[model samples]
Target: MTSKYEIRLNSKIDIRRIYTNETLPLRKKVLKPFLTEEECINPGDDLTSTYHFGLFQENKLISISTFIQEGHPDFLSTFPYRLRGMATDTEFQGQGLGGILLQHGVEYLRQKECDFLWFNARIKAFPFYEKLGFSYYGPLFDIKDIGPHKVMYKILIPK
Candidate 1:
């Protein structure tokens, strides 16, 4: 016997553009736990073309991801977006909130005429990015003690 099922959340979530300061603690907690909050701040985070998206439930910021107008050195495009500092609160992990954040983030970038979004995805998080239509390129490399990572990109094909 075989069966398939799904559960849709009718719950309301606010996907909003948030300031970088609003994202630091969650970024430190989820992404850069071993380092100081100062270490979690990425290079292009303060750029005018960078946009940080946060998922809020009942006014509590739960998950966040940043999109910047930085192209992958390998993937050339007029407006390639780089996805950075994506993190969901540990308490809310495995509930599909990360997927929601990516979906909304992609749409927002597409409207700005971005050709694609790319990032250095962690090995453990590879499956999650794959599910959202991102593919990998380049050899496996490392960041000091942060483990291995590969460059992954998702193209927003025109409809």
Candidate 2:
């Protein structure tokens, strides 16, 4: 049996454009608690072409990801977007909120004619990204203070 509270929360999930500052709390809590607030900020976070997205359940921000107009040297696409700092609250981790938010961002980029989307996905997250159609692009590498990661990419067929 579902309670009224559960119904309300399930019915009110929303994904929308958010400011960079709005993503810091979840990112810090879920992705990098060891880093300071300043270190949680990604490069290009303030750029005009950069966008931040958040998923909210009844106004509580639970999932976040940032997209920036950055290209990889190995990829030949003219317009490539990089996904950064994707995180979801611990309580909401397995509910597919992150996938929902990512798909929303992909649709937005497709509308904007982005050629491809890519990111350095953490080792433990490979299966999640793979299930979403992202392919591994490079060999494993490690970021300082962070664990292993691999470049993953998805080609966007423009809508």
Candidate 3:
């Protein structure tokens, strides 16, 4: 069962605090092989970016996600598209936090009238993207210093 965590659209949360939470050890472990220690996007980066959201459990960050407005074709931020960062406390896995975060991201982007929401999902996590209705696109690309990442996108329901 999932604990009570309120997911909201907050652009001011400190990214570092959320990204480094000890509860999400598995998240860190899973993403570690795919991203360098310095390359991981922290909460501060999200707060500073154009669009992002945080999940809180009684004022403490429990999960988080974000997207940046890409002017050209950056992987994380592509021109009004959202590059999603998702994390849940390791203890909270399998309880639906990811799904909640995913839904929240989509809804927030949809409200903003984003043309598309996309991200380079980890190959192992492709099923999660499928469940969210995101279609795989293009050939898989290794994340340079990280593991292979599959580009995925989903059209948002027009507002």
Task: Give TM-scores for every candidate, taking all chains together and pairing residue i with residue i.
Answer: 0.90, 0.92, 0.67
What TM-score does prediction 1 earn? 0.90
TM-score of model 3 (CA atoms): 0.67
Number of the top TM-score candidate: 2
The lDDT for every candidate, in the order shown, is 0.84, 0.88, 0.59
lDDT of 2: 0.88
Instruction: Return the number of clashes found in candidate 1.
Output: 0
Q: In candidate 3, what are the lDDT values of residues 41-88, reduced to their tens digit?
A: 444444444554556655556666666665326433333565645666
Candidate 3 segments exceeding 4 Å error = 1-30, 33-39, 42-49, 71-79
Name the candidate, 1 or 2, with the larger lDDT value.
2
For candidate 2, write residues 38-58 as lDDT tens digits.
Answer: 889988999989988888897
Q: Pick the winner on TM-score between candidates 1 and 3.
A: 1
Tens-place lDDT digits, model 1, residues 1-159 = 111211223456667778888889999998888988888889989999999888877678899989888887777687889999999999998989989988888887787788888999999999998998899999999988688999999887533
Backbone clashes in model 3: 5
Candidate 2 runs further than 4 Å off: 1-10
